[model samples]
Target: MDCEILENTVLLAIVTLISVVQNIFFAFKVENESKIANSKSSQKTSSPAFDKVYTANQNCTDAYPTFLALLWCAGIFCSQGPAAFAGIMYLCVRQKYFVGYLGENTQITPGYIFGKRVVLFLFLMSMAGILNYYIGVFFGSDVKMYIKAVSNTVSPFLLIP
Candidate 1:
């Protein structure tokens, strides 16, 4: 193909690589946290080590989405910029909630949790709206359909945030 096309292909490859590596990181975080949470639950005192699970892990919200990002990025050769951006953006959104709301893994503070959740919801919804609008045009689909597709694609990335 042309030089511009070659450059785009390379850029897309890089983006996809980043997405997969991010997924691996998410998986490790969740797996590690699960082990720690299980072990800590059995104990009387909540140890710092136990807390480490949440604090250290990115709360592993978007693992599935990250994986999907990797897959989709691969299929499109990174041509689907909206999808890739959504995947990564969703992960970031997840981390904020995971840390702000789900941290400490205690009975969540309801007020704090609700507030954080509302914020996250608004944020993601706005992003989904944007993707739905623009990408929808390209795909010759409705906003709702595009939104659904993008949202579904990034579902795995939807961290508890």
Candidate 2:
């Protein structure tokens, strides 16, 4: 690979790592706040509502890891506008996340809902698009070499250090 590509990859990796760490901390805060708001003051406790809150909180664990995956994977795929694309993807997930959780009883949610299937689909496509562009940009050898570059990245990296 060209040294420029390697340099860009390193920079992308560092930014993504930092972004992921920040997201994890943010998720914890969101979970704690949700727990407090969801908590009952006068009620005697012990209910499915609490269970729902716990489950929702548990789902927040992937907040940062997902971002990290997007970052690294995006670095492998996108040529530019990574932050913008990733940000849009993140916002999309947040909207879908809340709607999915409340989807058990009905399709529509009062605020937002969470759904695994939707998240899975969105994440996959978003990452794929980013990855595709990444391969096409710095790494590709020719105008038509995008797919080849992607294949190279997906393939095993045997000791080139």
Candidate 3:
């Protein structure tokens, strides 16, 4: 696999790991606050902290499929470099959203908006790439040539350590 794609995949894994860790940590916090030893029973308690953590984790879980689809689609169809950068930004914003939600729900807006924009950008990239591919296939427009041209024009600016 391409290094950029691999990097993006790793970023996706990291995002999952972060969510899992946060869930576990907050679960413990809720357990401690409620003095509930049983995980299942603890979930039934009506506590603000538990609700925040549950909602935060649940929000991430709900959006995960869409994020995964967008990440892979954009990484595979579009330029991996841009996809990877977007993935990193998405991860950062998600962390912000998670932490912010734990503090105050209102604080999550910036991260939520930024994350949605990143996903939208990935969707656009995926659409452009897929369109380019189909156009090339049916019209003999030479997708590789265009890709090469674009890569040459954009490569210098994308270089990273």
Candidate 4:
């Protein structure tokens, strides 16, 4: 395999590793927080911290499928290296968002803002990949060659690195 392909694979592997570890941490935090809340009260209402943890976990769980699908779609169709880099950034920012949500203030944090931006970027990249393929199919263009041509024209100006 080409060096670039190997490097992209490594980047993706690192992202996956970090994401798994982060998710495990989040799960532990949520469970710990829940336990603390339960110890305090048997009422339907949980503690504020517990509520925040639950919300954060729920939001992540809701978005997980969509996020992973878009991530892989962009990685395969767009530039894999950049896609993987974006994935790393997304994971990092998402962790911050999760942690920040557990704080006393529930207002949107910097992490939340940056995470949304990263998600928007990933969405656009995934759309570009999918759209490129469909456009090729409809226009009877050489899909791979045409995508390469278009990507070459656009990538030089991108500040991906």
lDDT of 1: 0.50
Model 1 C-alpha lDDT per residue in residues 1-161, reported as the tens digit of each score:
79876654554456557656755765676677667667767755555554554453444432444344443433243224444454455445444444544455453344335434433433554555556567767987655655556555654443444
Query: How many clashes in each structure?
Result: 5, 18, 0, 0
User: After superposing candidate 4, which stretches have Cα over 4 Å from the reference?
Assistant: 1-10, 42-45, 135-161
**lDDT by residue for model 4 (53-145), tens:** 999988776776676776777677765766676787788778777877777455447776776666776677777778878877899664555
The list of candidate 2 runs beyond 4 A from truth reads: 1-46, 99-140, 144-161
Candidate 3 regions exceeding 4 Å error are: 1-44, 143-161
CA lDDT of 134 in candidate 2?
Answer: 65
Which lDDT tens digits does candidate 3 get at residues 1-161? 78865764665456556645755765665556455434447456556766776677778768877887887777667666666667667777777897899887688998898888888877876786788889888997857446535633543442221
How would you encode candidate 2's per-residue C-alpha lDDT over 54-143 as one tens digit per residue?
555455554646655655554455432343344344445544454355347443342133233323433554566665566668787343
**Local distance difference test, candidate 3:** 0.69
Q: Local distance difference test, per candidate?
A: 0.50, 0.48, 0.69, 0.72
- Sorted by TM-score (best first), the order is 4, 3, 2, 1
For TM-score, the strongest prediction is 4
